[model samples]
Target: MTRGWPARLSSGEVTLRPLARSDRAAWREVRRRNADWLRPWDATVPPGSDARPSSFGGLVRRLHRLARQGTTFPFAIEVSGQFVGQLTVNNIVRGSAQFASMGYWIDQQHAGRGVVPRAVAMAIDHCFFTAGLHRVEICIRPENTNSLRVVEKLGLHEVGLAPRFLHIDGAWRDHRIYAVTVEECPGGMLARVAAPPETG
Candidate 1:
């Protein structure tokens, strides 16, 4: 169906678009430099499983195919037109569920500045509205305070702790699940994040 095609999703300074084969050079540069910064939080190959794919193009093609199958939206995040990271909306389940999960990473240089929250807001809005999803969730490791803040800023409710939920950094890591349903953000996810806090 290729419903969304991972189009250019923009919110203030952050922009996200489908990753391309041409992004190799720049993406690799940022990824390599941030290798130390991101490694501890990265997913690792499960023990005894077959070797994972080693090619970036192969990963891109798989994501593109998932988009066509109407199961995922994989995007490369950009700050002011410069590539900085990737945000992928995966594990899409339709039918009565209509749910999806998100995973993202940004260049360490762009750590703060509200980039991740806004980008997440934009993506959630698209999933709930344009893509007809009913729920979206983000799972983060306990020691990942920065990622923890991202979900907090967007006011996603804490679902619970998941023990040994994912394999990360070469070992099984527990995760804290945070989620928001369409009913929780009646004004829309993007608009909710843009709203000012109420004053007494």
Candidate 2:
């Protein structure tokens, strides 16, 4: 069985903590403000959907259950004293395969500010080093250029395409798969963060 891992992680300007009920107001505002920007790329929800409401309580319960089952880890992303987004490593498998799928979203206002990458790097380090996962995969809609750039910036390699991979905004959307194994992480994402920025 996968042992319990801590629910908090911090790196540079970001901190990832377990999602809490108190976060609802801030989270709701973030979602409300980013609604249009996020809609096309978001998972399908019913008409008149209120994700923050429908999913809030259920999310807490689900995270607790998944933590006990050793199959998922979810966190709220906080940067510079404000809740900005979420990051999750789901569908964890142990035994012969130590792997999980990565997913994340940032408030529209925080885009292009390096927050997601920092949070992602922290999460990747936790998964590979602390959680002992061998592989992590990120599936992104092919049209999400910004998200594609994130995975690429992290140095994950494109593995293949997943047809009808996910139901997004009411339809099954094609996604490009990218992966990075623990073995390939070398000095790890934390080290990569510390290294000098790549220059042209």
Candidate 3:
């Protein structure tokens, strides 16, 4: 494990920082308000699987422990010091396969103002330059147009589809895999995000 994580990253008003015990109120408030908006994309436990942490503290503790083990980076997404969402870099693998997958959600009120793309770029930059990982992938459900727009904005390559890849909203859902390697973003992904759009 490295010393700096769970790290704090920022670009303008968007920031990614470690989740903490004190974030219970703000986190719960945002999630509660956005439940209906987020339900379609949320992951659920299968019938036979063990129950996950019920309390906010337990969830934060578990993620912190995993961060110590070097397998995950759970972050609370904040815009100008106001908590708005979450972005997690999970399932990190080292050795021959230095890659990980990311998942995120944003408040409905802040959905399309470019907050997510900036956070994603920052996280990917950290994965490549700071964390020493080779590749980062984001798997999105086909119907998730907001998420699809994010990958499109960043120009990530769509590798393939994974049928029934993950259990989401209580059923097995297929996902489209989008990935970017360190080699592909040699100048860092944030730069791409900050660049002015190309006009046709």
State which candidate has the highest TM-score. Answer: 3
The candidate maximizing lDDT is 3
lDDT of 2 at 95: 92
Worst 10 residues of 3 by lDDT: 1-10
Question: Can you tell me which runs of candidate 1 are displaced by over 4 Å?
Answer: none
**In model 3, which residue pairs have backbone atoms overlapping below 3 Å?**
none
RMSD to the true structure for each prediction, in A, is: 1.2, 3.0, 0.9
Query: lDDT tens digits, residues 1-200, model 1?
Result: 56556578888878989889889898899999999999999998997987665888887888888888988898899999999999999999989999999999999999988888888999998888888899999999999999999998899999999999999999999999999999999888888668898789
> Which sections of candidate 2 miss by over 4 Å?
1-4, 45-53
What's the count of clashing pairs in each model shown? Answer: 0, 0, 0
| Reference-based lDDT, residue 75, model 2 | 87
**Once model 1 is optimally superposed onto the true structure by TM-score, how far is the C-alpha of residue 34 displaced, in angstroms?**
0.4
| Model 2: worst 10 consecutive residues (lDDT sum) | 45-54
Report the lDDT tens digits of candidate 3 across residue range 23-124. Answer: 999999999999999999999998899999999999999999999999999999999999999999999999999999999999999999999999999999
lDDT of each: 0.90, 0.85, 0.95
Query: Could you give candidate 2's per-residue lDDT for residues 1-200 as a string of tens digits?
Result: 44635468888778998777788799889989999999998887555656542667777777767877899887899987799998888899999999999899999888998888888888888899889899999999989999998887788899999999887989888999999998998688866666777889
lDDT of 1: 0.90
How far is 165's C-alpha from truth in model 2 (Å)? 0.5
